[model samples]
Target: MSELAVPGIAYGGDYNPEQWPEEVWAEDVRLMREAGVTMVSVNIFAWALLEPREGEYDFSRLDRILALLHENGIAADLATPTAAPPAWFFRAHPDALPVDRDGRGLSYGSRQTFCPSSPAYREAALRITGELAARYADHPAVVMWHIHNEYGCHNAECYCEASAEAFRGWLREKYADDLEALNRAWGTTFWSQWYYDWDEIIPPRATGAVPNPAHQLDWRRFCSDELLSLYKAEREVLRAAAPSVPATTNFMVMYNFDALDYWRWAPELDIVSNDHYLQSTDPESEIDIALSGDLVRSLAGGRPWLLMEHSTGAVNWQPVNRAKTAGELRRNALAHVARGADGIAYFQWRAAKAGAEQWHSAMLPHAGTDSQIWRDVVQLGADLRALAEVRGSTGTAKVAIVWDWNAWWSVELPSQPSGEVRFQDLVRAWYEPLWRAGVAVDFVRPDADLSAYRVVLAPSLYLVDDEGAANLAGFAERGGTLAVGFHSGAVDENCHVRLGGYPGAFREALGVRSDELFPLLPGEPVGLSEGGTASVWSERVRLDGAEAVTSFASGPLTGVPAVTRHTHGTGTTWYVATLPAPSTLADLLDRIRTEAGVTPVRVTPEGVEAVLRRGEDADYLFLINHGDRSAEVEVPAGAADLLAGKPVEGGTVTVRAGDVVVVREPR
Candidate 1:
């Protein structure tokens, strides 16, 4: 399939002309032209307006919107508006409404209220999609097909009768109608939960006790598959009507509650796109923005990706709704571009007059074009145009962090070693140090090829399938550096214990065996022999063939290996028995970097991120200062700063706080 066919970096964002009067649209286009907006996503939430009544459709308003955008020289990222079905359809077929885990029906006031398994919802969604695709296929404005927005966001799982029947049918196909296989996989004999037939199984709801681990795991997989089925249904119609137009749906990566497996969904998209909202509560929101962008690029298999939606200022959803500081918005958008996002856009073009997200920020805020937010938006658009040659370039990384949705599901299952052992926390714990070190890292699945990376980090990977285990082992045997953090490789894909010891499949590769897990209490920490502290979790490790690099100084597991290293073939494996302090992890990574012969792109003070994006003819180094104070950074000699339009002679360059500088060098 062709990639999203757009020249340069496609800018602009979701434009809901339906929400405003017809007179307001020309003004929107005029503002878009002034802001260097190249594209606008339209009709995302217009289902109710497009078809106000059942079997009745209206395109007059939509046609005008598309024509206006085209006449203003802006491409259209056309949406199907199927995310929120018309209220009439829900009223006609009440079964299409989803049910909560407590067996209560969800009302139709919010979007994504339809059940994925409901045949009525699927049919209606497809019909609307087909109509939109057929009408807009030949339109000059349509550049890409934006499928239903953020699938599996609100309605990830449903316990209604329709979903229950679909779940049984899915199980039958998965188990080949064999109840014995399902029983064995779920280990039902222990709980007397053995099923006699497919109909006996139901959606894993609030059982008296914790649901079966295997059952919950399968339910998660089933829910993800059901949503994928719905996306494919819409995508098929779009493809049939508009074969040349690339189709994509925005993904909310690591949003915690989203269960749609992006690794499974990435293959179905022509171009990968992601919607990232900063965690205003966390000070490390910049790190998260870069992390999500890198993951999306990796999901695109190193191809360029789109930053589909972010915010220009304060988002209404967060508790505090903090607005962006002076230059933070520009820095945030450049961070995505530096990491490999070809296009940058936001959640809206204009702030809404009346809606749930009325207070949300936009290119044109409530204060209009004179506001600082609008000024920053226009500057970002001009900057994108200035660096247009960077489009289609890719970031180079010698480090990879393994990310698996199945493992994320398994580690967070109830009855774990510690409630504090969250998947994202563990990942961020390991990711923070590398990110601080200015090391460009790519996120890869356990099964991804490891030959290109010198270092691979797998943190809190509780479930490691046999194939993934073999892949990791082979990566180590082939002379790559491997780091396995706490509680990794403990269970199989079925959530069954690996039986021999803790960190079951990785014991041989890591050359260590864990006998017991000791979760630390809050504010409690154990000292490491290497000087820093380890907290949150610790394990009693018995070194088999590995050397203890860091030993626990004082704790119940004192004298055990807090960190160990083993040499296999030409490679080395490091096993972290606890969550080390950031300084400790940084020191450990420095050592690993030395052993792997991986050099940093450039070293700078804290809050300054350095990354290099290599194109066919030029290499661009992005230096972003995320601090509150200005900092000086070292640059390579004879490189020209693209943003400043000047040459730097391999000396120190002062970068203001929350500012970005791109240095272009000959490849």
Candidate 2:
């Protein structure tokens, strides 16, 4: 907690020395050194090697790996190899096998296949983690404790008696032993699914009651809690043995594994880390990554986070995996650092030869360290190590965007007019303009204090759970302009739709009632004029106390409110009825900036994305060229691009594609 101290941008990744021979291990060490890898994450998937049978363990291979890493002047992030249960353990306790939607117990082959709520699995996992923690907790080479990897990918719940009983207990605690209350919360009246007893409720599966959303929603919440309990148990063991070592697991971003609520998990983590992978070639890719980075940072409350698992090149599992361009990896890495990352680590180090991810990118590809990919890795490492301090140093951002998981969960869980409403899309729309404007931003959930910002943007915001609507109202009442978008506040925390009307709980604050929703079909446009279109879901609303700021035209909702505004205590709440094109969003941002008395942090000459990260007396200005052509950016005539150690003259600094120019302005 004392300012997370890693030597530098901790590099190196899931290293499995046990996977190869001694000679190959030696070669890997040499290659890692060349790649500027100072930190090695070892023993990620070595459970099979560590313990081949029940009540039996071996630590020699891991000892050698840790020792070799230390001997080479590299740090080791020791993993408690519980990611994959040993075949012996799974064989010994067949109950450890996961139960699928069809009630079939899963066979052990892939990793992340153990049920979190299974007592047998928990006992075995605890024993292994406890043993490992006790054995290596004090080793000088060990820097952090990594619990199970990607903790919640397995199917949720087991129809086995153990899980059924556990679910009953959970139900009793949550609903006070009242079946009626439980039935009401789950809205069990639908489909004649009313529960007579706690035993009547079963884990919702894809096969049965597919249309029963309430039951499915509860299942999601239950799954999230179950996995969280698993993580807590592992952390408990690690904390007892290695109290000083920060413990965490890598979180997959926007993942459907409902059990891992990052917001709830963030505080428990010594350092919040996330894995993000995308296959898009669009300009919005950077914006998406930036939003995710900010989300992690906000979870850490502005503390630096770790880019736990990014690929060096193409990912193998995506439907259409594309290799990163020459400079794309570097650009993405720096983008995270610029936002607020303390470290960067990839999913793998050595290439797998016979697994599902065999073709996934690695630090040492199948071609070895002599390949072009290896050269890129080495160059990137050299650059990071060269500018180590600046890369790790914290940056301050004035503007913030709120990201809430509860709202996301409860909002989309409900059956709305159109199943096409995506909360992630709305969030992206609000964030892209701020990113393009070079506005330094942080992501806060609705409950987070909004007193610091001149403008707060909450897009989609469908549920407004966790005091979000009130906070937005408070921010506006306190003279802060808030821009909220479609489906803002329609449900409560219980997944119950707000009683009054759509935007139910927030209608009074926003001064509008959503009367009708119009779904835009493919190839159809909700005209914003000037050739811009909102081509997804459109809404028709009438303003009560709010004034119509923008209107839809040439569509079913034409002349209705596309955007509306209401005067709150001292500021305003603007509601956008549909997802607008970037130009319209930018225009809205311009209006907000003017009304909120805010200005662009700094303007670049052209072709560069300029961002300012302010510290007390030192302001870090990042001028990155995301465009194909070289960009000339204006700086204070004599201010230096600190990372390059070159001074700017006549306020001009030119940067090439994927190039980053870091300028430090001293007060």
Candidate 3:
């Protein structure tokens, strides 16, 4: 934002000057400026270097780094370095070490080994935060306050005795100190387990049998809240010291993370940011980038968010690290900007010569400036400078998808109907069709307001509260199209099954009820009456007031409804009783969207990704080609290609393979 003093899209990555010699510091700055870098994250994981011993401070190294950055015209995304504490603190306060579910206390060797519930850890972290704020709040190169590194990457929860005590305290507050209320919420009567006293409860630690679903659910909620409290505490100290500086922590809101409830966490930050790394082995990984970017944009309430971290080439963590092809790097980076990234950054500027991530790709690779990664880095820098006017552009869409952390946790808990029912996979199944059709969509909590949406899909919403059900029903009642994913509406907020039938909470609105679920084994494909195969799941459905659009053809539930449509009020709702083949589902989604009257300004063909970001004066159109063949996009009238700095010829342009075309059109 303008408040952060970044003139355009901020570039650069994590800079660990402490990791290298003094001779390398100057060279890094020179390389940074040469790459058109404006900002770099500094001091992350430097706690050991900053405060070598407890109560002893040494700012000499960080002082030189910041001074060097300022001299080179590079602003600093200054991190507080609380994510990793020094070895001396860990040795002195071993009680702060986190314990796993089976009760093995983690030793201090890697980063983020400290528990969030440890008071000793909290006090020490805040003390360092306050000291950093008091000293460098007014520094010339400081632009934004990066409060901590990825918060829940390593130690999101701890099952130690202190954490158990903290859990009890959190429960007391949640239930207002009423032990009986806690029992009702946790549904402890099934196992003859009733909590007469607060001390009897603990995080659902290792047990011989299945643990309580509601207990596990609450533990997840508490863990997320505990970490949020730590961030808030540090943020308050930072604000008290320097209120003008915006504060944020990078959220790993992609595949490797499902720890924090970002719905509750997004509003706490001055600006929302996220770290998105492509899963190396996923052939359709670009779709994941779109999903991640849309989610971060939604988390920021449709405002442009920072692309906090990504890899320039192969990342070190995957099974087999594969290098990006010739045009793959810019495709990944610019794709984020197309969705709603105001700034783009990578994880590290220079690949390390030593450490766990020495093989991780960076802007300046180990092979030096002669490598392709460096050449691509130089080209991307020039490209970013050319598209500087695209800042402050915001993305909006009428379609919304429900993404809930609580439901995801409970749906994947032990003792469910099927272990193959993945929440993330189901969501992608629903979203990929829309993404391929070039329809922009935002993610919302189930209970969030849906008045702005014309269509909403809740995929595998196995656990929903009454409030969320009412909200979804109300959206359909008010003339919004709704798609109820298979296996959804079966359970309430407390993990209690809604007993009327399957798809219980939505039975009335959907006007259909399933008698039973038939979860298929791998390679088992049940035929649908609509000339396609349904796999992974199938259900015996009975229509109440709905029309059967398709029926099961080969299962024991043959002649039963496979899919149904019901008209509720002025709106319509569709119930999917099984996971349909990709082509069949895409066709169904297109039909629903057409009936809902949801249309883009122009249709994007099969291989192109079309997105619009509206600024005060113009609407920027991004057409990215992810297919083998070239994609032809009809350029909007009076539009200019921002990338090439020229007008479109013949009112159209062909996007070559893996290339991004940004067109600027007046609003």
* Candidate 1 lDDT tens digits, 511-577: 9998888889988999988798989988889998999999999889879889999998789999998
Best by lDDT: 3
Residue 280, model 2, lDDT: 51
User: Which ranges of candidate 1 are over 4 A from the true structure?
Assistant: 649-652
Q: What TM-score does each of the candidates earn?
A: 0.98, 0.94, 0.98
Model 1 Cα shift for residue 379 (angstroms): 0.8
Worst 10 residues of 1 by lDDT: 1-10
Candidates ranked, most accurate by TM-score first:
3, 1, 2
User: After TM-score superposition, what is the CA distance of residue 502 in candidate 1 from its true location, in Å?
Assistant: 1.5
Candidate 2: tens digits of C-alpha lDDT, residues 1-667:
4334467677777787787787787778887887888876788788888888787888998888888887887788778787788888877888777787677777888887777678888888889998898899898888888888877755545556566667777778877888888888778777788877677766665463354655655566666777778888888998988788888778877423344567777788877777877655454477777778777778877777788888888889767778888788888777777777778888689888877888998888888777877887887787666556554456456566777766666556646666667767677778878777777677877878877788888776766654777887888888888877777777666666777666676688788988766777766768864346776777778888999877887788778878888998888888877877888788887787667777666776545676666556566677778788887766665477665666767777778877887777765
Order of candidate numbers by lDDT, starting with the best: 3, 1, 2
TM-score of 2: 0.94
Shift of residue 301 alpha carbon in model 1, Å: 0.5
Report the alpha-carbon TM-score of model 3 versus the true structure: 0.98
Candidate 2 deviant stretches above 4 angstroms: 2-5, 154-161, 176-178, 207-211, 254-259, 280-284, 529-531, 605-607
lDDT of 3 by residue, 304-402 (tens): 899999999999988999999878999999999988898899989999999999999999999999999999998899888888999988886989999
What residue pairs clash in candidate 2, if any at all? 224-259
| TM-score-superior candidate, 2 or 3 | 3
